[model samples]
Target: MIEKHTSNNGLRIVLENIPAVRSVTIGIWILTGSRNETNLNNGISHFLEHMFFKGTNTRSPQDIAEEFDSIGGQVNAFTSKEYTCLFAKVLDTHKEYALEILADMFFHSSFDELEMEREKKVIYEEIKMYEDTPDDIVHDLLAQASYGGHPLGYPILGTEEHLKGFNADTLRNYMKEQYIPENVVISVAGNTDDSFIGKIENYFGSYNAEYKPSNIVRPTFLANTIERNKDTEQAHLCLGYDGLPVGHENTYSLIIMNNVLGGSMSSRLFQEVREKQGLAYSVFSYHSSFLDNGLLTIYAGTGKDQLPLLRDTIDKTVETLIKSGLTDKELTNSKEQLKGNLMLSLESTNSRMSRNGRNEMLLNRHRTLDEMISEIDAVSHDSIQKVIEKLFNQSSSTALIAPDTSG
Candidate 1:
């Protein structure tokens, strides 16, 4: 059973009770991330996520870690392009303790000056680590090529210069503006009881309810290619096209179309490019949907000499799908594949907590498991073809990292 409640200050709480499970996963979802940042504070969302674990007024960082370890619980957090989440999974008996610790971190983080300085160095090293990985950095380049000047294009990990500028005041000011009761969702799933809501209310009910409307300019897609010559062995590439935002009617159809095109190991790109031609080792397609826009991207890593062949194969595969569409067998197989994956993934308490939290955060509503299955099942051949035609006809932007032969 699933239940939802809203506190007087506007904090939304969602709970899923699975009597069969022995553990519960609780998540505090905040509606702010890299997209809410400016050039001056590009990576503050992620930086702040790291600082949340450093300490609170009542506990030191070591105390926080040791407590979770003693309880045999798992605690972590991640910052994305649109939001941040701090979450934990623990035995059902430890629910109150888990929530109390999270509440303390959320309400009382001190952001010590020395800790902030030390964390900046850690993040700087993280940035350097990502820069050294061409396959990883290519995706960031693709975002820049696709969105250009939009905040969506900025790296989630800000530049070293920007990181150095963030002190206690900078973090506090940003948090004051972004972290309010109205901008959060608390989700708990698994072997939970009716008392969970009251516990969440007690911890988070007193926050100020403030809404700050964002004035970010929506990004326009630019069809251009960017390339960097490196001394690496494999040439990494990402091809991106404009896609639909979340909750659009055509999003489901697009998912089906993507699956048949390049999403699965049995997908056309994987079969034709890697299995048949042996052109590339890693090949797949994925779509990212944000509040106002989306991106459909295909990625491949291959030998520099095989780049042209790989590109031609991908282009041909897309053209074939557009012209001929999917066969009945292909459509049925893809739908079942998607449905099975969805059902199997929800068996975990963590997945259920994430799904409930993200749905409430992004769509402001909950979709039952049956409703999602119905949506995927209702996708028709005509709908898939239409989405394919619309998506494939658009101009695409490409980002490439190739080995430099000039040396």
Candidate 2:
């Protein structure tokens, strides 16, 4: 059973007790990320995520690491476009100690000036690393082309100039505004007892309860194309279209459509573009659903001479899917594929913790495995057709990074 509790101070707690398991995964989710950022502070959320592990008032960075390692546990965190998460996995017996350490970092991080400056250089190198990898940078470029001036378009890793400008106060101000109790969710999955609930409440109950209204303007889709000439051997391409937001009714149908289109090894794009015609080495499609909006993207990497053919092939694939739609056999196979993957992923305690945390943070509700499977099963061929028509038939933006031929 999944249990939920909301403290008076507005920290939402969710727990799924798996009595058979000897371990637990706990996640602290903050509902703010790049979308909440201004152009001047585009990557503050991600930067803060990094700083949280640097040290705290009572614990040095080494102490934090040593404690987790001593217990044979793991601690990590990540920042996404919509939220940031700090999480740990430990034996069920060690959960209390793990939570204490996490709470210490959460409530008492001491973003030392020296560490801040050093991390800035580290992040700058991270940004340059992405710049050198065209396959990775092409998606960021496509996002910029698709969303234009919107905050969603900004890379999660802010520019080098922006990183250089960020100081301790800049990060603290952003955290002060965004990281309040009401904007946080704590999720735990695996072996747990009733006492665990009270413990979590006691740990988080004193936080300030505050909610700030976000005035993020919805991004408009711009079907523009951008090309960057780099000194690389292969051309990397990304094609993006507008997609539905989280919890949209048609999202399941769109997922099914995506699978049949280009989501897997047996997908049309992979089979046709790579296996049959030998036009490209890699080709796939993905859908990203956010709070208020989403993006459907297709990516392919191939030699410069094959770029035009690859683009045309992908375009034709979309045109064909929009025109012909998926057959019943195709829909059935895709649904089973999605269901198998979903069930397999849930076998991990960490995956369950992440699912519970993200659902509560993003949707404020929990969806049972049965509920999700039913939704997937209920998707009809016509529903998928409609999704393909609605999303893929629309205008799309393209981004290409190719070797610079000009002298």
Q: Give the TM-scores of the predictions, in the order they appear.
A: 0.98, 0.98
Tens digits of lDDT, candidate 2, 79-169: 8888999999999999999999999998899999898888888999999999999999999899999988788888998888888888888
For model 1, where is the 10-residue window of minimal lDDT? Answer: 209-218
Model 2 lowest lDDT segment of ten: 209-218
> For candidate 1, what is the TM-score?
0.98
What candidate 2 gets wrong by more than 4 Å, as runs, is: 405-407
What's the lDDT for residue 405 in model 2?
50
TM-score of 2: 0.98
Screening candidate 2 with a backbone cut-off below 3 angstroms (N, C-alpha, C), the clashing residue pairs are none
Candidate 1: where are CA atoms >4 Å away?
A: 405-407
